[model samples]
Each structure stands twice: as C-alpha cells, then as structure tokens.
Target: MAELAKTSEAVHRDYTGAKIGMWLFLFTEILLFGGLFLVYAVYRTKHQADFHTAAAELSVAIGAANTMILLTSSLTMALAIAAIRRSAKTASIVFQSLTILFAVIFLVNKYFEWGAKIGHGLYPNSPELLAQSHGTILFYGLYYVMTGLHALHVLIGIGLLLTMLILTVRDRITNTDFVKLENSGLYWHLVDIVWIYLFPLLYLIT
Candidate 1:
C-alpha cells in the first residue's frame, strides 16, 4: 500500500511539472509574437496610409471565415478535454476529430488565399511588390512574416493534437491522467488566440 501511495505521489508531481513546463513554453511563445506585434505597431503608425491600403488588398470575407473556423475549433478542443475528464471517451474522440478537421480546413483556406496573393505578385521579393512604396513594402513584409509564422504554429498545433488523439485512442490518456490532452489544448488555444489578434491587425486594420 505504501508503494502504491508513493507511485501515485510521483505521478502527481510529474503532472504538476508538466503543466508548469507547458505554461513556461507558452510564455516564451507570447514574447516572440508580442515583439513582432510591437514592430507592427511601430511600422503601422509610421505608415498608416500604406498599412490601410495593404490591408485592403486582403479579403475580409476569407479572413472572417477563417476566424470563425478557428473559433469553432477552439470550442471543439475544449469540449474534447471536458469529454475526456468526464470519462466519455467516444465523445472525446469525436471532438478531437472535429478539431483536426477544422484545422485542416483552415490550412486549405490559407493555401488558396496565399496562392491568389502569389498569383497577383504580392509575394515577397517579387517584382510587383518591389515596385511599391517603402511603407507598402514594409507592410507586406510584416504581413508575410507574421502570418507565415502564425500558420507554422497552426501546423505544429495540428501535429500535437494528432498525437494527443492517438494517445487517447490507445487509452494512454484517460480521465485520471489526461494532462497531455490538456497541454495540447492549451497550445491549440494559443494558436487560436494569436489569430484573434492577427485577424484584426492584418485583415481588419483601417
């Protein structure tokens, strides 16, 4: 009995450590994006007209759709964690699957959006973009850099959630030991929150 007690205490300690580690990792991510946001603010202030014109080139409809998709995914991800906590394994799997689907959809939308921009010669280092004013050039440069980074994060989140889904399927993540899923959910939420900020700064800026 003492042995079992010791093992349980060790597991609890591991869980606590894992949670703290994830939070620290998230804090670092926040700092990375926060610095970029500060850079964006400075440039936008210097070239408000260029920023407004550049933002006009982006499609609000597409941006709004992707925002809704990510918001829904966040909801589904939370539901997945909640379902697992309640020991509803099937519901958890369903929600996880839905979250993955939404993520894929988002990427697909981004693909077409990027393709259209590239087709129009808006991509970085392209002759068309190089001809633009200094402010316009800076705006597009920041747009591509920031949004590309955020998209990379989305891809990483998808991979993490996929791993969590597989673990849950294998019963490695269950009601009593689901910190892995919780951590993945937190990462996914960070991705979503970053977009919440990005959508406005990149898409809705006027």
Candidate 2:
C-alpha cells in the first residue's frame, strides 16, 4: 500500500502544480490589461467631454446584448464543470457546447458592430477619425484596441472549451481526472470577468 500511496501523492502534486501555473498565467493577463486600463483612465480623465461624445456613438443595445451573452456563457461553463464532477458526461458536453455557442454569438455581434463603425469611417487612421478631436480619436483608438484584444481572448476560450468537450467525450477527462475541464472553466470565467469590466468602461461611459 505504501507504493500506491506514493503514486497518489505524486498525482496530487502534479495537479497542484498545474493549477499554480494557470493562476500565474492569469496574473500576467491581468497585468497586460491593467496597463491599458491605466492609460484609459488618464486619457478619459483629461478628455471627458470628447470621450463622452465618442462613447455616445457606440451602440449600447449591442453592447448590452453581448454582455448578457458572455455572462450566460460563464454560467454555462460553471455548470459544465459541475456536470463533469458529477460524472454526467452528456450534460457536461451540452453545457460546454452552449458556452461555445454563446461565444460565437458574442463574436458575431462584435463583428457587425465593428463593421458599422468602420463603415462610417470611424476606425483608426481613417480620415474621419483623423479629423476628429484628439480625445475622440483616442477614445475610438482605445475602444478598438481593448475590445479587439478581448474578442481575441474570447476566440481562444472557445477553442479551449471545444477541446475540453472532445476530451470529455473520449473519456480522457473523466470524473476522476477532470482538472483540464475545471481549468478551462476557470479560464472562461476570467474572460467573462474581463468583459464585465470592459462593457461598462467602453459602452456605458456616456
């Protein structure tokens, strides 16, 4: 029994190590966005009027819709983890699939929103934006940069969740060895948290 105990301990240690690595990577992501937020705060403070004007141009309805979509996705992701832990493989897959569906919906909304903005010649380096006030230009610039980066993260999260779904189907992520699913859920939640902050800052600023 001593040999079995040693093997079990090693497995637990590896799991703990994996969790630590994920947390550290998440911290780095926080710092990356933290810098952008700092710059935004400074610029917004100095150019509140222009920022408000630019923010008014954004579609609050679409932004709010995307916010709801992502929040629901987070819920579905959490449910997926629970379903897996309960050994309900099919339920877990369904929840994860729902999460991915929500992600795709969010991206579709963003694509249309951005397309409208670009159609109006409001994008960065466009003559329309170049002729705008410095604060307005800065507002749209940050909007695109921040929201675009966040969307990229959403895409990455979709990929991760899809992989988790496949693993669960193959029994590679069974109830007894489901850290991969849990970690993927954690990452999804992190993405949702970032959007929680971003939605208000960009869309509700007026």
Candidate 3:
C-alpha cells in the first residue's frame, strides 16, 4: 500500500517535469516560426500583388480539407491522452490509432497538393516554376519555401505519432508511463497549431 503511494507520487513529479520541459521546447519552436513569419510579412508587403496572385494559386479546397483533418487529429490526440490519464488503456490505444489515421490523411492531402503545384511549374528551378509573371514567380518561390518547411514538420509529426502507436500496441508503454507519449503528442499538437496559424496567413493574404 505504501509502495503504491510512493510510486504514485514519484510518477506525478516525473510527469510534471516532462510536461514542463516539452512546453519550454515548444516555446523555442514558436520563436523560430515567428522569425519566419516576420520574413514572410516583409516580403508580402514588398510584393503584395505577387503575394496575392500566389495565394490565389494555392488550392483552398485542399488547404481547408487538410486544416480540418489536422484539427480532427489534434482532437483525437487529446482524447487519447485523456484516456490514458483515466487509466483506460484500450481506449487510449484506439484514439491513438485514429489520430494516426487522420495524420496520414493530412499527409496525403499535402502531398497531392504540393505535387500538383510542382508539376505545374510551381517550384524553384523548375522550367515552368515562374509562370511568366514577375509576381507569380516571386510569390510561388516564397510559397514553396514556406509550405515546404511546414510539410517537413508534418512528416516529422507523423513519425512521432507512429512511434506512439507502436508503443501502445506493443505494450511497451502504458498509461503508467505515458510521458514519452505525452511529449510526442505535444510535438504533434504544436505542428498542428503552427499550421492553424499558417493556413489563413498564407492563403488569405489579400
């Protein structure tokens, strides 16, 4: 009985430490993203026409769809953590699985959208990338740069979620030891949150 109480207290302290560290790491990430956003703002003001034209070229349908998918994934991820907190291992696993599925959907949407743009000469160094308009070329160049970076983060988030899925399935990590899981979820949520801010700014800069 005393052993269980001691274990519980130790677990509580460890959880607090892990979560705080993750939050601090997220703050650092915010600063990085903030700097990039600053650069974007400067370019946007200098080339408003080109920026608008570039924004228009982005497919709103796919962007909006991915936004919804990521939002849903965030919700599922939250649910999974909640389930773990409640000591419902099976429910947590199920929610984590769903979160992974939503992540894949988001990746697929991003891939298709990006690939189409690149195929249509929307990438730097591509023969058709510049679209013959000064604004189009500059705007598309920035577009690819920003979205490409964000997409890389998305890919990393997917890998993190998959790691959680594996840990849950293999019983290698359970609710009792969910700090790594929580940390990964934190990272994934940050990725989603960054996109939430990026989407409207990048796509609606008119």
Candidate with best TM-score: 1
The alpha-carbon lDDT assigned to residue 198 of candidate 1 equals 96
What value of lDDT does candidate 2 attain over all alpha carbons? 0.92
TM-score of each: 0.95, 0.94, 0.88
Please provide, for model 2 over 59-175, each residue's C-alpha lDDT reduced to its tens digit, 9 standing for 90 to 100: 999999999999999999999889988999999999999999999999999999999999999999999999999999999999999999999999999899889888988998877
What is the TM-score of candidate 3? 0.88
Which regions of candidate 2 fall more than 4 Å away from where they truly are? 1-13
lDDT of 1 by residue, 108-174 (tens): 9999999999999999999999999988999889988998998999899889889999999999999
What's the residue-level lDDT of 152 in candidate 2? 97
Each candidate: RMSD to true structure? 1.8, 2.2, 2.6
Q: Report lDDT (CA) for all predictions.
A: 0.94, 0.92, 0.83
Clashes of each: 0, 0, 1
Error of 3 at 75 (Å): 0.2
Worst 10 residues of 2 by lDDT: 9-18
Give a tens-digit lDDT track for model 3, residues 1-206.
99999787766667788899999999998998888888788878887887887788788888888899999989999999889878888998889888889888887887898899877766886777644676667677667777777778878887887888788778766767778888988998998898898899877766
What root-mean-square deviation over C-alphas does model 2 reach?
Answer: 2.2
